[model samples]
Target: MENSTIVPKSSLDFLTQLKENNNKPWFETNKPKYLIELNHIENFAGALLHELSKTDVLETASGKKSVYRIYRDIRFSKDKTPFKTFWGGSYTRATKERRGGYYFHIEAGNSFFAGGFWGPNAADLKRIRTEFAHDTEPMQKILSSKSFVSNFGTLQGEQLKTAPKGFDVNHEAIDLLRYKQFLVIKRFTDDEVLSPNFLEQALETFKNMRPFFDYMSEVLTTDINGASVL
Candidate 1:
């Protein structure tokens, strides 16, 4: 796979293979191919992150951290994938833990790249929900923007104060379980509508919303929104 330019076809397939053959021995067998794919995925994700940051709409979180971790935890799940082929995006500032960033998942006619809170664990989700509550007005305003609507469809602001139907938001061990990452997971149908140029337009829209995140970061720290909360 290293010398080949196309690389492996499906990320799901790679994961499935890893899960099928459990044990260090199996991993060692596929180590070379896995490393190559991992490198490719990292390069692509890094490029996308850099591109978004250059626009001033998004800022890459920095500091001592890891990029493109290929480890997979399948302890509870019946299906196990030893490693992941695709690299998800993440960012953090100096000395800060890599809590939230950006991630792009591509699927057949269902491609979406998410920004905002990307925490898969409990504490991160709580903090994001709290932030959302504190800055609900501005968050809604950003959601209502023409750009956001055009790309992701209408969004409803759900307060984290209440527990979701299947989720135990109040469970003592709730913080231990992984939760959805983004406060907002903008979804787009992979149709004729989602061309390269269309994605570029969406990126610009997200860039436009970057100020909202910066504003919310401050507002979350200080419960005051100055004059206009929105």
Candidate 2:
């Protein structure tokens, strides 16, 4: 209910202007405004972290720590835009026991909440594929649940056009096994992002991801014998 938790219209306006004028000169002139908006976003991230900690453990120390830098790393990119057009951040769950992560992106028309394994290592990918190949029912049930469907629509991520080396193309769980990354996403409209209850709504969306996260955590932390790896 705090004012800091609310996304101010001015903040969004500033981002919109930044997108139109992405040059360093324009940004330098408006640096003060940018800093003010960043503070609001940091407060929102901090408050979200506080609420999230009540239900889950996080390794992120503070809201500021969770926020991604506004400056884009363009060393390897063709688009040499010096500043990012949006504000984004992520939260990593605490310990090796808790797998997966949480992310939020705030932009004029692209606001979204996303969480899951963006890039699984070779070992973890193989293990996950093995589990799906053995039995897809558990993961299938979670993905097919009403809450999951309502929130994320469907499982999403990069996938191999053909099955991975060890997985059969015709395997029963091949659809899931082909995935190289596991992710779920929920988008929000500008109206929704600027709403008073946006913070609470964001928390609810994160909470809804628990079943999928818990399932992956179990798979990643154990061997075939179901013993802890960590």
Candidate 3:
């Protein structure tokens, strides 16, 4: 970091060290260190929000509103760790409706930023698939764009083995229609985050991927503003 970075070396060190000692006793003893790291993450989220606001409207883009808690929900998980070994956050709309959003994860060696809606419910999934059936061109353009592909590689997450219900097997966009989740991600090394130009890289990554997010946002948006036919 030339001057200073929101996420410094110590933040990464804290998380990496925590992985070895992931018990309450260790955590209780090192709570101050954890809080400092968490604060750094919060500041980083705020900085990202500022960058995104220039291109898009992040309705709920504050640190407190967007940062995720470190506490793990081990209710039904196999690895029942008491806390997380990473610091994370999101920049998204305030509404409960499913839509595209931004995510940031900072761990020891696994720093990354991911965007797009993940695992929408049955109804939302139906809506997205229905939109694809009507006109695949819009999403196709986004998927095939040079910048989009370069940044995110391709749409990711689980996909169905066959065509989804209500969509024909022989449909023109059958390949895309088989997708159950619409997501993309960009990974970074710990050194990358610690670089002097990390913030610039972060902003550019988000900007490059904004078009895809906008496309998915349009797909999931449900507004009933038209005059009632009835």
Candidate 4:
């Protein structure tokens, strides 16, 4: 196992170059450099996974599997950039019972770690909304806890302008009911990303997400009666 746990300077430098020369020709010429950086990132991810698995089960098979492709699909977008200028990835929790996911992004000035339900299907959305409508205290407690506040600051994601159909606009939990997505994010500076203990710090930050994750997981896996759905 590779012992180095820091994000290499070369990786960031290469990404900076890639941002300037995002065309196919420039990328083709610099493929070897990219590969080297990718390897380092893969190893870093692998190490992170190894630590993460000690506390949580993950569906992602390996660090390499968690890394997102640098390629950008521009099939219908105005921004025709062929490649991403940063390293990004995610890990999904294993099994139906475990809800939420973890994500990491490494970039020059905009690196962050985030986890939550980016998208909940119609059924899941309704379920979460119903739970919040009935009782927002549980979720509220998790969001307001000191660790949660210190780490992520607050819950974030898209929200409806008004109440959903069948939900009263003046509902007590209307703020919670308006959510279209659920996410929490923590940012890090470039210097922090390159630090030796960044891996451990990342793990701790992820650990702080457990209260929110566990709450959501329980809400998701059980029906309104609190019986197991899976």
Candidate 5:
């Protein structure tokens, strides 16, 4: 029952309790514990924000903007759980207009640091695919680097069954072109998340993602139709 957590040690205990009692009354009773962990995450978010700002990735970063709600949107779900078992958040680009950035997530057993251009719109996807089609080397260099591959296995996302209309089936970068979303993750275990060095490790992982983000920035920040289209 003692928490010497400097930066969000773990909500694992509370989450386990929530999973067992997944009801309003139980949650109401445990509100204080939830708030304590929530504040821990807020502090973690603030530290992450500072780290990101150092690299100019997050412009006007705020812990409030970076942290996500613990409650789940259960309106249309079959399970209909009122609260989530984890906490997470996103750090948008310093430009504010840029569409893709970084994400931090913490769950009982599935903690990870993720980032990239997730689910880009049709127009944005086309632009990026076109860029890859013409010059795949730049993006390929980043994805294939030792640090990138070690930190993030690969560009993880949904892909189309067939190639887009403008590209041929035999195109060299067809695989990259077929991607509908560009997301990547670096996972961590429960012990790792609670470690004193967790913040340092998280920041380093984020640093490695810079090249990939920089590549996306070219398209996402390009002035198209008089506005930046992520």
Candidate 6:
């Protein structure tokens, strides 16, 4: 694993302060510290990505050589800290159009990571939804796996089974929409992210779940024929 510095408490505090000081000239005043933190996060993300790449798990799905990135979308939001509360990383096969990335939620602490195919546009969503519905059993099996279930919380999975909002799982396409992406959601609480043993456990969990991604990759690459899909 590439070397990473423990994200400093002072750094997080400064970012929180910057977010609260809307009227003040915080950016100009704290330019150096801000730049340093940004760089530090970038390095940390890169290191984490390197560690992930060492495993052959993310072959076709992740699409890019450099997996980690900080999301740069900050429009009409109350939180105006220049730095992000999270960093994300992922890879995909060369054939895929774009990189598949996952988030490291900082507010929930950084060891946690969640990833799956996301529908940025209508066409993408359509393909994913179609595939999800086509091979429901296999998809459900992976989602319900002990390892996978642990990540999303058992209660959340049961809730998802009922479908979203007014949607019913008994409905045809609508009910199956949530199953479209092969999401591998893992949680690392504050203690886990901050602790070495917990962090190691988290990484091992990612490694163990690698097979599920492999299964999804195979299914996605296969033709739409229902029998051959999963």
Measured over all alpha carbons after superposition, the RMSD of each candidate to the real structure, in angstroms, is: 8.1, 1.1, 3.3, 1.1, 3.3, 5.7
Clashing pairs in 5: 59-94
lDDT of 3 by residue, 1-230 (tens): 32333568888899888899888899999999888777777777777787778877678647667788888899999998888988888887545433577788888889888887686889778877887888889889988999888888888878999999878999999988898877888999989988868888888887887777666656667522322222
Query: Tens-digit lDDT track for model 1 on 1-230?
Result: 24212223443355556656655788898888666656655544454455666654334443112254667677997756555434344554222322234545544445455556543455445544555543456656766787767655643223344553354565543332223443445655545223435445445645654654565455434434343322
* lDDT for position 135 in model 5: 81
Better model by TM-score, 2 or 3? Answer: 2
Q: Which digits, one per residue and each the tens of the lDDT, describe model 6 over residues 1-230?
A: 43353444444555556556533365678778766766655555555555666774345332233334433445877765444444344544343422344445444334456655554344454554566666566666776788667666431221145564444566565555754344556776666555545435545665655656565555554556635332
List candidate 4 segments past 4 Å from native.
none
Stretches off by above 4 angstroms in model 3 are: 1-5, 94-98, 222-230
Task: Give TM per candidate.
Answer: 0.55, 0.98, 0.88, 0.97, 0.90, 0.65
Rank candidates, lDDT, best first: 2, 4, 5, 3, 6, 1
Model 4, position 203: C-alpha lDDT score: 95
Instruction: Find the candidate with the highest TM-score and give its number.
Output: 2
Q: What is the lDDT of candidate 2?
A: 0.94
In candidate 2, which residue pairs get closer than 3 Å at backbone N, Cα or C atoms, i.e. clash? Answer: none
Among residues 3 or more apart in sequence or in different chains, the pairs in candidate 1 whose N, CA or C atoms overlap within 3 Å are 19-80, 61-92, 62-92, 62-93, 109-190
* Model 1 residue 60 lDDT score: 49
The number of the candidate with the highest lDDT is 2
lDDT of 5 by residue, 26-60 (tens): 99998999898787787778877887688765654
> Which 10-residue window of candidate 6 scores lowest in summed lDDT?
153-162
Clashing pairs in 6: 60-93, 61-92, 62-91, 62-92, 63-91, 63-92, 63-93
User: Considering summed lDDT, which 10 consecutive residues are worst modelled in model 2?
Assistant: 1-10
Better of 4 and 6 by TM-score: 4
- TM-score ranking, high to low: 2, 4, 5, 3, 6, 1
Candidate 5 RMSD to the correct structure: 3.3
